[model samples]
Target chain A: MDREFRNNKPDMFTVELFDATSDLAESLAHSEVIMRFTNSNQVLINDQDAQRLVQEANELHQKLYAKDASRDFMRENFPRYRELQNQIASNPVLQEQSEAQEMAINFLREVNQEISQLLGIDFGSLTRRPDATC
Target chain B: MDNLTLNEPEVASKSRVMEVARRFTETLAETAQYRALEETYQAFRQDGEAQAAYTALQTKQQTLRMVTMLNAVGEEDRLALKQLEDQFYGLKSVQNYIQAQETLISMCQEIGDILSDAVGLNFGLACRVGGCCG
Candidate 1:
């Protein structure tokens, strides 16, 4: 028998049962994740992680410059990439020489903190849930 | 109906993992990199302000160099977003998979309830009649 037939054509009882079960699962999962993310507060990206990320970004920047036109698909996406790159390159938050790295870290910290509040969820709860993480 | 396996202490089964992977692959490919790059490139290529700004960097290089730099920056942004999104994609995929299964489980439970109700009402009658009176 067709799968849809088995599912969609179920008698009224089966339909009601499926509806109740699916609703419970959705609610439970959503609640679990929401609580977890709320509890975990904000995830901290240490200097090391920040450094690795920035280094990777720079490396990617250079490598793309080196690629031949036909070899890479950069042509497809150069415009918005340029804007983001310009933002990184020009932002006072990112441009400070003596405090640039620290500034970046602080900026990210601020952003993450704001995000935490915006999300109104805890990180601890996120981890406790079976597979929920943000 | 789906089983509740997210809370299981062990590793998720391969099928669950695969389901998550498939869900993210499309999001990862489109939103994270290719689409953004294309948009950024258009901004850089079409706007005078963008051109003037980029020309500073462009002047230092030959035509190929300029192309390469734009492409380079584009690639850099794409990769950065990709890495960031990949991490997010991974986390969300697991969460989503678990959530989806939870939904299925709930559905199954509802189905079970409905079956029980029907049996209470008619299963005995059906057995007695046997389609056309066995």
Candidate 2:
């Protein structure tokens, strides 16, 4: 919108740029990685047992750091917590969800690497918040 | 599966994706914030008084590098250095450049957020240089 830039004037570059960005956004939205991540996340969120386990873990974690906390108390409860986590992790649906989530992340990282290569700048880093260490 | 070719079809479309990325970058460069940053940066560079003040500050800082590191610099020298820095920062072009650069960074963060959410990973985090920004 600034009148100062020569490249900002009406031109083929502008049209191409707009079309490219639109196409990219649409493509990204329709990406299988995105769809899989969304579905897997929903499934994870809807798992009642998983939610209950998470809540229990949080409660136990809070109690571990309470004023009356003890290493022995942590040792006693931590194993049960780990057992529950292992059980939840072993669920076929959760396993698929976890794999899908990881797949999606890898896919995105590859995509970002490609973009960074094209721009000769780390597109992902450029877009990161200032306060973010990584 | 071990090599992470989760989807061959998606990988094949990498070129189109890069084209989209290039277009997006072009559009971003054309934005008011980017334009303002460039303009202000040029102005800052061309500003004789600001440049002189900055050069003087840098020279003084270099000269007092050891003393400052050891916290042995006198209060008078420290205050003088601080005053020089204040004068350099007080320039209109310098202030504008800093503000514009921050605005551009914010814009980049927003765009990165969208990409990260779409891909289900922190894209910005992955692209950070040395896992941090200066």
Candidate 3:
């Protein structure tokens, strides 16, 4: 009862879902919008927009990959947590279990909501970019 | 008495029967596996070691291909193992489950068929933009 759900989080699960959602966004941005990769030089898909999708996508991909490393901490410790949760499932003192479980649920909800928002924007207007031949 | 007897087209009769059988059997199997996968995801989401084992599963979900969506069914199963702490119905919403799965098999496969002769890779992960997306 004394434990705060948000204090200890399941950051790994959040990162995993985030990474997956970002992948879809990256692909769409590449083909439909940014179009291709560039380094120092910027290329245009046609006349107006810069074809730097590959670079943008790579940046996003790198961010996702970097954040993904946090999962290692969760991956390393989740088993012990489960073991404790199972052992204490029937116990009248659920303060600790409740705390841990709540933290996880909240973390997942945050990730789901965040990824949903990201996809909503990327998929909505960006996906509908006017069709043009490059 | 013979007035009730209707002559059926040769292809029509066989096709109708086959369709009916496929629907019944596929629905049953899909339901069972879907439920099992849901449980597995729940279990895994709550457990970390299982989550690590499922890295391949996670990668598969995000991979672009015509069938990536279809391939994501397996992701649901893997998620069950990762050890999330959320409170959810042991049973997922039937409509959501069906829609997701249906999209995987139908949309993914259809997209794959439309894009290439092959059936795997769903839509093509990372999609490089090395060649024409269309």
Interface RMSD of each: 20.3, 6.8, 18.4
Indicate the docking level reached by candidate 1: incorrect
Misplaced by over 4 Å in model 3 are A1-134, B1-105, B118-123, B126-134
lDDT for model 3, on a 0 to 1 scale?
A: 0.33
Between candidates 1 and 2, the lDDT winner: 2
DockQ for each model: 0.02, 0.25, 0.02
Return the lDDT, model 3, position A81.
51
Model 3 residue B120 CA deviation (Å) reads 13
The interface RMSD for candidate 1 is: 20.3
| Cα lDDT tens digits for candidate 2, B1-134 | 85667443242254556566666766776777767887898899999998998899899999899998998999999999999999988988889889987776766675665565545556677554355321
Superposed by TM-score, candidate 1 places the C-alpha of residue B74 at a distance from the truth, in angstroms, of 31
Tens-digit lDDT track for model 3 on A1-134?
Answer: 11111132223223322233233223322221122121111222241322233344445445445656567655665565555445445433333334433332332233223332533311111111123121
Clashing pairs in 2: A127-B108
Residues B32-123, model 1: lDDT tens digits: 22233444445445656444534443443343465566666466655654554444334433344445444433333333333223222111
User: Which of the numbered candidates is closest to the native, going by highest lDDT?
Assistant: 2
Q: Which stretches of candidate 2 lie over 4 Å from their true place?
A: A1-22, A62-68, A114-121, A129-134, B1-14, B46-81, B113-134
Q: Provide the TM-score of chain B versus the true chain B for each model in turn.
A: 0.23, 0.81, 0.23
